[model samples]
Every structure is written in structure tokens, then in C-alpha cells.
Target: MKIIVNAEQRDVSGCTLAKALEELDFISTAIATALNGCFVPREQHAETTLSEGDRLEVLAPMQGG
Candidate 1:
């Protein structure tokens, strides 16, 4: 299905949030995820389900010296 991922349109599939992440090859080191404005813990990804029109915000950690 076509959905907005971090404000960009992309194709993602699977029955749950965990599956979608796997399908999209979202690496753990690259970002942290918030679904519909709520923070989702890594351990809860498998328990969370993705629904239509749900907004996802991916926050990428930056290194500062």
C-alpha cells in the first residue's frame, strides 16, 4: 500500500508495524519511529498495528561533537 513515510510517499506492506518495518528495510540504527504522533518503543513494534491514514514521523539521531 502507498503511505507517507516521514513525509515521503513509499510502498509498505504487512499486517503489523513490525512487518511494515521489515518490508521497508528500516534499520534500527537509522531512526526512531513515532506513529500518529505517538512514540513507539522498539519492543512494542511487534504489538503495534498500522492503519490507513496513520501519520508516521521518523526521527533520525544526529551526532554532534
Candidate 2:
């Protein structure tokens, strides 16, 4: 399926958010995810379903002083 990740188009095989993260090499990284403008909690990632044309925002924390 095709989805937008961080403003870029990506083709992913996973049907759930967790699987998609793995496919994108972000499974082990600490990040925040939002689906179609709504926040998806970390605990729900495994059950969150994704569809074609879905817009996802994956945000990683930045370190700064």
C-alpha cells in the first residue's frame, strides 16, 4: 500500500502501524506518530490500521540546549 510518511511518499507492506514502522526501519527508535492529524499512542501502534493515501507523521525527539 502507498502512504505518506513525513511528507514523502512510501510504499509499505505492513497493514498496521507497528509493522509499517518496522518496514521503515523505525521500530527500535523512540518516536511519536500521528495518523491523519490525530495522535496515535505508543501502546496502540500495534493495533492501529493504516490505509492507502493515509498521511502519517513520525517525529523523533531532538536534543538541544
Candidate 3:
């Protein structure tokens, strides 16, 4: 399926958010995720299903501010 990840179009095979993240090589635990402009908690990642054309945003904490 085709979805938008951090504003970039990506093709993913996983149907769940967690699996997609794994396929995308996003193994870091220190990150935040949002699906289609809605915040998705860490625990829900495994259950959250993704559809084609969905917008996924992955953000990691940054320092130096």
C-alpha cells in the first residue's frame, strides 16, 4: 500500500502501524507517531491499522533548544 510518511510517499506491506515501522526500519523507542493528523500512543501502535493514502508522521525528540 502507498502511504505518506513524514510527508514522503512510501510503499509498505505491513497493515499495522507497528509492522510498518519495523519495515521502515524505525526501531527507535524514543519517538512519537501520528496517523492522519491524530496522535497515536505507543501502546496502540500494534493495533492501529493503516490504509492506503494514509498520512503517517514519525517524530523523534531533539535537543539543543
Identify the leading candidate in terms of lDDT. 3
True-structure lDDT of candidate 1: 0.79
Give the whole-model CA lDDT for all candidates, comma-separated: 0.79, 0.95, 0.97
TM-score of every model versus the real structure: 0.78, 0.94, 0.96
Where does the lowest 10-residue lDDT sum fall in candidate 3?
56-65
* TM-score, prediction 1: 0.78
> Which parts of model 3 are misplaced by more than 4 Å?
none
Who is ahead in TM-score, 1 or 3?
A: 3
Model 3: per-residue Cα lDDT over 1-65, one tens digit each: 99999999999999999999999998999989999999999999999999999999999998996
Sliding window of 10 residues with minimal summed lDDT for model 2: 21-30
Indicate whether candidate 1 or candidate 2 has the larger TM-score.
2
Residues 7-63, candidate 2, lDDT per residue (tens digit)? 999999999999999899987558999999999999999999999999999999899
User: What pairs collide in candidate 3?
Assistant: none
Rate residue 61 of model 3 by lDDT. Answer: 91
Superposition error at 57 for model 3 (Å): 0.4
Q: What is the lDDT of residue 20 in candidate 3?
A: 99
Q: Which stretches of candidate 1 lie over 4 Å from their true place?
A: none
Work out candidate 3's RMSD over C-alphas.
0.7
